[model samples]
Target: MRDPILEGALRRVRDEKARDRGRRGRLRAATSAALAAAVLAGGLHLGRHSLPAHRILVATTGSTRMTTTITPADGWVRLHAAVDGIDPGERCTLVVTDSHGRRYVAGGWVAARREHTDLDGAALVDPADLATISVVTVDGRTLVTTTA
Candidate 1:
């Protein structure tokens, strides 16, 4: 009861539809992957900007070197310094100077018998007005100074 020509035509149409469905499925998977990658990239960008930026300064004088990282927040600044090449057991001071010649002592500690000493200090000064950061000896000898 079926015409051979009509049956052949219907078979071709069904085969074409199956191929089209496979293509569509592949395209959908690709689009989903692209969208997920974009969302992840955007999230990383936002997270990076949400954190405070840290400014690092390093200086060396003679055999002494000082590296300082400054973070400003809420009208105050925090400083983390690593000092090297100073003699062990020497008392040292971390000094933060403003552009107006005002000095704020961040913190102080005795040098340990190690390769480097790490010090943490905070100052009640605006970060924009920071001028110089110095590591000085207890008797007023400057070990190193870095300009901010």
Candidate 2:
């Protein structure tokens, strides 16, 4: 014969254990869903940047070399350039020209003791309307030019 009080206590403990198991199962499902979502998002992010884009060789010199990789996104062309042989504390400007002969300029100063500089500048001109992009010195000497 079973003791009535002990039987009730054991039944209560079993019910509590069942509830804890259910909670643990739900937590695992939630964690798995979150991890899958994160992986998918990461893949999409990499896919956007991994696609082939236009790489235009802008300039090649013994002392300095530059190249522009133009990636089309939305309605505009994104410009990225790697520049070298720039003197420290020198002022440099980026110029972009449209087919209509309008020029856009982005200017910045180089760092001290830095011999190489990487420039990133964008133009509002559409990829179709872009004529040329160039990096020029303050005295108007062209350093790098990419024609579209």
Candidate 3:
């Protein structure tokens, strides 16, 4: 019942639509690949140079293990520590003591207990002034201590 000319035109239009969908699919795949590559490159770059190279490991009396790392960046002494085996909701303070016995409280936080926790802060004194770095509980218990 359809005219020949109209049917031919409809077929051509459907073909064009199919071609557009294929083109779009290819473009979408390319865009996704490009985004994934960019993310991987950024992550590698950050992982390579973001932290310091020197680290000291210390074990706490509470059965927690910690590693202290010192990073000197932008004329600042950055003290960082990684701790594991902390109880969920437990509060702890990161303490930095200078050779002259001056104490600086970098920061404190409550553990989320996700198997490990990281704590970091900038020391007000020079890197050479650091004597001992320790993580202590609110009850004056030394969780971990490392001499600089």
Let me know the TM-score candidate 2 reaches against the reference structure: 0.55
Candidate 3: count of backbone clashes, pairs at least 3 residues apart or interchain: 0
Candidates in order, TM-scores: namely 0.64, 0.55, 0.56
Summarize candidate 1's per-residue lDDT along 7-105 as a digit string, tens digits: 999999999999999999999999999999999999998886553688999999998989999998657789999988888898989999999999999
Candidate 3, residue 49: CA error in Å? 21
Query: What residue runs in model 1 are displaced by over 4 Å at the alpha carbon?
Result: 1-52
Off by over 4 Å in 3: 1-62, 73-76
Superior by lDDT: candidate 1 or candidate 2: 1
Native-referenced Cα lDDT, model 2: 0.75
lDDT by residue (1-148, candidate 2, tens digit) is 9799999999999999999999999999999999999999999998875535675766765566667777765556677777777667666787878999998774454535446677777777777777887777778877667677
**Top TM-score: which candidate number?**
1
Instruction: State residue 21's C-alpha deviation in candidate 2, in Å.
Output: 40
- Order the candidates by TM-score, highest first: 1, 3, 2
Residue-by-residue lDDT tens digits, candidate 3, 82-126: 888878888999888889999888878899984789887877856
